[model samples]
Target: MITLDNVSKKYQTRDKGWFTAVEPTSLHINQGEIFGLMGYSGAGKSTLLRLINLLERPDTGKVLIDNQDLTAMSEAQLRQARQNIGMVFQQFNLLSNRTVAENVAFPLEIAGWDAAKIAQRVQECLEIVDLTERAQHYPAQLSGGQKQRVGIARALAPNPKVILA
Candidate 1:
């Protein structure tokens, strides 16, 4: 479970203007349930999500994940905790120069997985997204949906518990 209790974020401009991005917001998300944060651009949805991951610290209140306070964790602890959360952008950010397999292997490489494990995971992820046949194909060769599928596969390769869309 994830809980945001009276969380808020503020940005101070050079001109001494204070912008309140996320107000004192409180929310709860249950495990095994798909929760969504929806809004138009600049509605602070992204900021709220960032707060949950401690990508940006809240100015007030707390962010708790699975009953553990994420806001109180150290930077290293936050990084480790963030591993269980996956994020996908609206734009499919695949590397055009790399093959589908390579793109899927990127995250594993960042997490310091061995080459053999990377290869195995890439294969499994590709299969999960029904893109095994397109393993050697570059992003340019695939359709938009196919590219997004590759992104999803890459995000899931780490076995994240929470997916931030």
Candidate 2:
């Protein structure tokens, strides 16, 4: 389960004023459920999603996943915790020079997976996103949709328990 307890975020503007990106909010999303946030642009949708994974830390309240409080975790603990959470960004953040397969293997490599295991998982993830045939293609060579698929493949390579897209 994902729980946001009165989470909020704000940014300081160049003019020395504050811009509230997310107002105080609380929500819960249970496992095995699919949820969507709908609103006009700048409605804090992306901020909320980032809060869930602590890519952007909340200024107030707590973020919990399956009863673990992400907000209170130490940096090292948070780094380990993040491996179980995956994110696919609105902009595909693939490395321009890395091939699709290499992109998918990036996280696994960071987590210290052996080469053979990384290669196997990369192939599996690529197959899941139907990008196996494009494994050798660089991000610049792919169409937008294909690049997005590569991002998805990369996010899935770790078999994350929670995926925020």
Candidate 3:
């Protein structure tokens, strides 16, 4: 489960000085539930998601995943905790240099899985996304949907419990 308690975020701009991206907001997403935040562009939707993952630290409030306060976690602890969370970006941030299989294996490698284990997990993830046949293809060689599948596979490679996409 995810909990955001009175969370707020702000950013400093060159000319604007300070811009409030998200106002004080509180939300909770229970386990096994589908949650959606809808808004027009620049409405802080992406910033809110970034705040959830600690990719952008909030200026106020707390983020708790299964009762562990993400805002208070040490950097190492945060890294480890993040392994249980997964993310897929609409932009499909695939590494152009790596093949489809390599892209899927990246998260496993980062999580310290052995080469064989990474290979196995990558295969499994690719199978889940139906991308096994495109294992050797590069990001540039794939269609938009295929690239999105690669992102999904990469997120699933670590077997995360919570996915924010």
Q: How far in Å is the alpha carbon of 108 misplaced in model 2?
A: 0.5
Model 1, stretches more than 4 Å misplaced? 95-97, 140-143
Rate residue 90 of model 1 by lDDT. 63
List TM-scores for all candidates, in order.
0.84, 0.96, 0.95
Model 3 RMSD in angstroms: 1.2
Worst 10 residues of 1 by lDDT: 83-92
Ranking by TM-score: 2, 3, 1
User: Which TM-score value belongs to model 3?
Assistant: 0.95
Q: Per-residue lDDT for 68-118 in model 3, tens only? A: 999999999999999999999879999999999999888888888999899
Error of 2 at 146 (Å): 0.5
lDDT of each: 0.87, 0.93, 0.93
lDDT of 1 by residue, 1-165 (tens): 889999999999899999999999998989998888788899898888778888789999999888889889888898788788876656778888999999888878888899998889889888999999999999999999998998899888888888776
- Give me the runs in candidate 2 sitting further than 4 Å from their true place: none
Point out the worst 10-residue segment of candidate 2 by lDDT: 92-101
Which predicted model would earn the best TM-score? Answer: 2
Model 2: how far residue 125 lies from native, Å: 1.1
Give the C-alpha miss distance for residue 112 in model 3, angstroms: 1.3
**What lDDT score is found at residue 55 in candidate 3?**
87
